[model samples]
Target: MDKKIKVGIVSYRNTRPLIYGLQHTALSNDIELIEDIPARLADKLKTGEIDLGLVPVAVIPQLGEYHIIGDYCIGTEGEVASVCLFSEVPLNEITRVYLDYQSRSSVALLQWLMRESWGIFPEIIQAEDESYREEIKGTTAGLVIGDRALEQRLISTYIYDLGAEWRAITGLPFVFAAWVSTKSLPASFVQRFNEANAAGIPRIDEIVAANPFPVYDLRKYYTLNLSYQLDERKRKGLELFLSYLKKDNEQPVEA
Candidate 1:
């Protein structure tokens, strides 16, 4: 490697564990970490601003070539509290939906669920920014993701967990984001990267202490709600979701 690897990391609480490992270990010396929302991070990766990114799986189809260069991912087996649809009324009753601009995977998953599980086609609006959060009212609901979604848990009357919905529909774990690169990285670098990530998985207390989120139980959120391993089941879940994205509007298919 001629230069330090520039890695795009998501600026969300869910990614703190991985960040902890990078900052605490020698990996920090080898890479430059640029933190931002998932959507922007994907953009950086696309524009060659970064060598690798913890980008949304939804961005996979858009990339001409990609290397999912990790043994870890931001995944969940069931009920991921952070990625949700917030509504005052029942999901089916809502006539309009706002997709979070900061997200890619959550919005895509919600769209898939609307077509398949819910069997309703609400007006989908892509939110421009944080100002759109205030528009979540009446028949106009919104899909919120990451830390903001966690904060929203306090105010939202009706919350629909996308992870839980996907589980009920497909009976598999869902992966939101993974470490990906357009170029093939050396095996030696990949090894250290995995080790660095693994080192942070056990440091829950350290992570929370470093970056406190008093709005929710950060510890439980890290330990249970988010799964880091990109195992066989999660791989299948990722593939299944991507398959749905590849198809068009056809009144949904049976899972």
Candidate 2:
């Protein structure tokens, strides 16, 4: 028998729509699904722990050569409520910030926003675990992501949505992640994969209702905040982000 293709995906609420019907379809027979945090997904893909992953866009530049397999992605048209920096004070007053260990793309986005957009330099501490969450007070802020970030919305005094910040920096939409593989996958499998992903978007209401989120409104999140299609403008945004990841773009970029 032929070996099943190993596929990795993020264990976050935002990723639901793109993978709605994957397990129920016959595609499940040919693919082995694995779930992990976004940062870990990047690591796994790099080490060949899995064949392909719905990983952060930040990892693409490091892969040397990678294939983005699907037509859909985890992106935001304007404000993304889930990926945020929570603080008690304003951006300028933040003396230190705890960067979440979940998604490297978010961490890089925060760094870029601080350097290019916000222009506030703070002591960046890598948060190894959820222990850093409680430390967010006074001048110390914490960057929380995924489902935990959604919960932070209620109590956090000041929330800086990085997606909104990116939208402000460039008028284009931001793609947080997409389906990427270390090597080119078969065209037939890729087509079926994307079809299963596409089947999920229109059934957003059904998906959310079936799996209710405790913290935030999943309905509004899927329809209003999150954008799935990797259209031309989002591709432009992705290209710009990859360019910024290069060492040369650090010296005062326009976009």
Candidate 3:
């Protein structure tokens, strides 16, 4: 029997297709999915707890010798309603901003947008607590990502989608997560993974139908808002994101 490649993936709504489709398909025999947060997955990937991961793009710079095998990614062309920044005051006037711990990419993107585009230097606050609404009451702004952000739509007065902000600033699509392997797996295995991912994209409607969220307009969200393919524009965004991490001032922990 072949050795199973342990794959750690976050239990987010975005990862649902990859998680379910892979498990139900032939790839299930060769790969094992370990549910974890993005940050924890980065650590697991570094420590060899998992062979491959669907990790945040920000964590890629830290991984010393990882190979991005697949051409698919969790990306967006316009407003990603899930990853948002809610501000009580105007963006330029904000003094302090709270960040979501679940995301590293959104955090870095926010910093880049705020510094380069907005010309603002608000103090960034990394809050452990999940209540962004409560945090925003005291702070000027709050950065929230994933399903929690989607649920708090009523409370948010001024919502700024990071993906939309990125497109507006760079005129390119943004990739949040990708399939990164620490070592070069066999060509057959890589092909299998790619095939599974490609197969999942077409069945996104079926996946979204299973979701508990009230008719999230999956067609609009998947077809119009998000881009599953890793094209040249997303590659440019990934390169730009890596550059931001490598800056002398930005001391990101090397993997």
Where does model 1 exceed 4 Å of error? 249-255
Best by lDDT: 1
The predictions' CA RMSDs to the true structure, in order, are 3.0, 3.0, 2.9
lDDT of model 3 at position 207: 82
Where does the lowest 10-residue lDDT sum fall in candidate 2? 246-255
Model 2 Cα lDDT, one tens digit per residue, 29-71 = 8888899999999999999999989999999988978998878
- Give me the runs in candidate 3 sitting further than 4 Å from their true place: 248-255
Listed in order, each prediction's TM-score against the native is: 0.96, 0.96, 0.92
Evaluated against the true structure, the overall lDDT of model 2 is 0.90
lDDT score at residue 113, model 1, on the 0-100 scale: 90
Report the candidate with higher lDDT, 1 versus 2.
1
Taken over the whole model, the C-alpha lDDT of each candidate is 0.91, 0.90, 0.81
What digit string (tens of lDDT, one per residue) describes model 1 on residues 1-255?
A: 678999899999999888888889998899999999999998888888999999999888888899998789999999899999999999779999999999988888998899888998998899998988899989889999999999999988999999999999899999999999998999999999999999899899988898888898999999889999999999999999988887743447879
